[model samples]
Target: MLSRGGAVENDRGSFREFVEKQKQKGTLVLLKKPCSLSLELAGVMKALDGKPVYCDKIKEVPGARVAGNVFCTRELICEYFGIRNEELMPKLVHAINNPSKPELVEGKNAPVLEVTEQEVDLSKFPIPFHAPKDGGPYFASAVGIANDKEYGRNCSFHRMMVIGKDRVAVRILPRHLEEFIKRAEGELEVAFVVGAPINVLLAAAISVEIGKDELQIANSLAPLRTVRLESGIEVPADAEYVFEGRITSEMVDEGPFVDLTETYDIVRKQRVMKITKVHHRKNPIFHVLLPGALEHKLLMGMPREPTIFNEVGKVAECKGVNITPGGCSWLHAVVAVRKKKDDDGKNAIEAAFRGHKSLKHVVVVDEDIDIYDPESVEWAIATRVQADKRLVIKHNEKGSSLDPSADPNTYATTKMGVDATKPLVAHGKNFEKAEWKAIKKEEYV
Candidate 1:
């Protein structure tokens, strides 16, 4: 997180700075109307289609404000990082491969611990009910920070449903957090941080090797200053609300909430967390993430882009990679490559599948094709692709659990890869589009 301009230039130090920058850029939409966490706010997010917004008034939960659409688009991410979106993958790849350790500071110096409440009450915060059929108000943007003595620190996102005043039912997937908690004797010390930096959020979402510190990756992306909580767990110093808690050896009903696939996930008995202390700044803003919306999709999908790029780079000169919005940014992808040989496209397609195991469909195209544009990718597939020669299908492969078409029991689905690159030969020029004379816009008008 190097400063770009000068002393006054925005280095995106904290989530507050990021929001302020968005406000100045006229990209942060302020919704002043009294909003409800139940459906009103979620409805607004759906209507905006992941437009960055700031809400000053929450009717249901008084004195609590919120911000959303933080990770809406690649351009928005580019603006935050002060780089072109085209450079994002390379930057993330570098950060993931070569991580920088974070500096641990005292909680006294952190703004998040400015006000600490010993009497923990989850209802005090404006935790939004994102989906219509959700069990209760969920902290979807809450990034959980946990540590094991042997395994070290772990940062990851988990959905926490407000079941009681100090109790939250968390849907703990079988990941690093789950593994950390399992290794513990009784309860695992955890800190659920809200309104952390975008870089921290992205780092938490990525799946690094077990025992690897995701915080280090975050520090590589941007300086991630952490503070020790009362529970001895470390969390982002600039977080809006830091709920020091422990994952109790208790199971509770969670979910039936909308998942990444924009469908209701099955209700299950999940782990319960007992929040012991709540720390916050003077006036905190809750970062809300709409379930199954663009924010959720991007946060879950974009981290994989860099991994895909790195994997494809091993085999081909990968130009760009885009996780299509239409595919929920998880089940599908489009990879652009500077095709040196006829097999470059096919190699990239296979490498992409390896990069992202959940990917169900992939399209590999020439560098001339705009991977971001569905129309352009489709054109390449229509003109350059042959069903028999270009299509590669792998059936019964382990895919995303969110994919409804996949076997729910096994999470197995068929994966397809389409090599849409033109044949590399003397007659390859035949596939090029006919040249049209360039016209001046003013003259044409």
Candidate 2:
């Protein structure tokens, strides 16, 4: 039953190309079970444990099939960017700093416009209910696209909850989209792109200077081809689904939705999006992102790695960075550096905090330690850190709003950093882990 939708021949720029590439690599999983959008969050979360595989087999929603966990791991992201695992952060930082302009094509040539809904109805798609606290079924995988005459075009992920057949309540933070909406006199033209390519998704999440077009960043990672909508908004030509809409002046209660911190965000009056035109490819596979899951954490955290790396580079030879899932991948970070001076660890800790202001705690480790491995990072902290000498703390710092402990009104909290790098006097020999001689496992078995 799950194997019904075979490979859809795709152009070079379509998201289906990436899916087909992953499928060819044997990393895509097709689930055959029919699942309720609200009830299946846990099942999808469980299926993505420690692996980044594409899963499809949702049949519960009307007029759609659903898939999830498209960018859950570094390996998958590296695959999409055509880079090696170790080159991920540097490459991202470079691409973000230097972006390529996007190429635009006519709307009639786009696959997303292959079918257009005469009447705008969002309920026809299986936008998942990710958590019990969520107010309604929300579009968790959407990368919203909007344009400003000055800013050109902007793409970012904004949670949209389906409130009516053609209405969605969008949680708009003070960013490019909000700025663009403010620039627009009445209603802001927008496009909620579902199932965008991996590059586009990452580009949307990055924090860049205002007036910087994220589509160009997507093009820097890979050549991004866009199609002009009837509304004049440009979207990735190969997106699975595109909802051309407008951000209206009307406001609605839009929260209690799970955030990146895996906490229920309080309800707030947010702007509403009135979808005008719904366009999609034939037999489109709906992309659903489980809120507060690994997918959410990775997408939110990985983009920050470059910022942290670039900041720490000024003070030390920054090796790598890992935003731990335990820290909600937003409020905590682990930075690895090749210790040159005795204070390089401490310097890196301060630099990292500066890189991401929302960080509440940071741990700096030696080059020998693997930042991705929690146990290794913990070991470095245990063996090398002296609380009185290595600890750095700041009071009443601006922090993540998702942190339950922070003052919600001000988004302020205490922040700390730990210098877990070994002393320079030791010459690193004493800190090395004991290793066993290599042997053939086949012989022993």
lDDT of 1 by residue, 11-38 (tens): 5368877887788878888997888888
Q: Looking at candidate 1, what is the lDDT of residue 312?
A: 96
* Alpha carbon lDDT of each predicted model: 0.87, 0.82
Runs of candidate 2 with Cα error greater than 4 angstroms are 1-13, 24-26, 45-63, 427-429, 434-445
Error of 2 at 123 (Å): 1.5
Q: Give all TM-scores, in the order shown.
A: 0.96, 0.92
lDDT of 2 by residue, 259-369 (tens): 887778999999999998899998887777777777788889889989999999999999899888899889899999998898898889889988887889999998899
Which ten contiguous residues of candidate 2 have the minimum total lDDT? 1-10
Candidate 1 regions exceeding 4 Å error are: 1-12, 426-429
Q: Indicate which candidate wins on TM-score.
A: 1
